[model samples]
Target: MKAERRTQWLRGVLDLCILGVLYDGEYYGYAISQRLEQAGLGHIKGGTLYPLLARLEEMSLVTSRWTVRQQGPGRKYYVLTEQGRRVFEEQASDWTMFAEHVATLIYRRGE
Candidate 1:
């Protein structure tokens, strides 16, 4: 799909998407973006991601720290806070239920 179309598809879900990604483990901005791209979420960009990271940090749902690695450059990594983990659990449940409902609708739409 085109980048613009993909961007439209991901508009309102960017925050949750980022949270879900961070749930996997801590990651810096570039690595996070790269992972999303690798996962076929190429539309997600720094413009959309950094602001959400800032907001999540402001809400105390995530914490960040700088990590220096010998293999590459030092980067600021983000991880979910305890509160974030709890929220992730709740949001994941909600997303699961919502997705099932939407899937059913899509599957039965022509019936």
Candidate 2:
């Protein structure tokens, strides 16, 4: 599996993934990207990530707050809204089923 192939697939589910991350708690932009990579999503750049965050905000799926820090510049942290939680739950269930079906086809398992 090449990186480009994965990137194409990722676009379809990035929003759900971001919501899934926020489900645990709040995270700033950079940390969110780190968590995504840690979860094997790969490195998502700001150019790609920030706009998605903005779109999520616009969609009312997530809300953000800026926390001031004495040590350095403040960061905007994002958290999932109540509606976002519901949406995530629904999408996650759908994705799980869809992924299983896709895997079955790809692997020719249970045929």
Q: What TM value does model 2 have?
A: 0.95
> Residues 11-109, candidate 1, lDDT per residue (tens digit)?
766677788889999999988888888887774568878888999999999999998789978899999999998998898898889889989988996
TM-score on alpha carbons, each prediction? 0.85, 0.95
Candidate 2's residue-wise lDDT over 1-111, tens digit each?
A: 798899999999998999999999999999999999999999999999999999999999999999999999999999999999999999999999999999888999566
Rate residue 102 of model 2 by lDDT. 93
Rate residue 11 of model 2 by lDDT.
92
Measured over all alpha carbons after superposition, the RMSD of each candidate to the real structure, in angstroms, is 2.0, 1.4
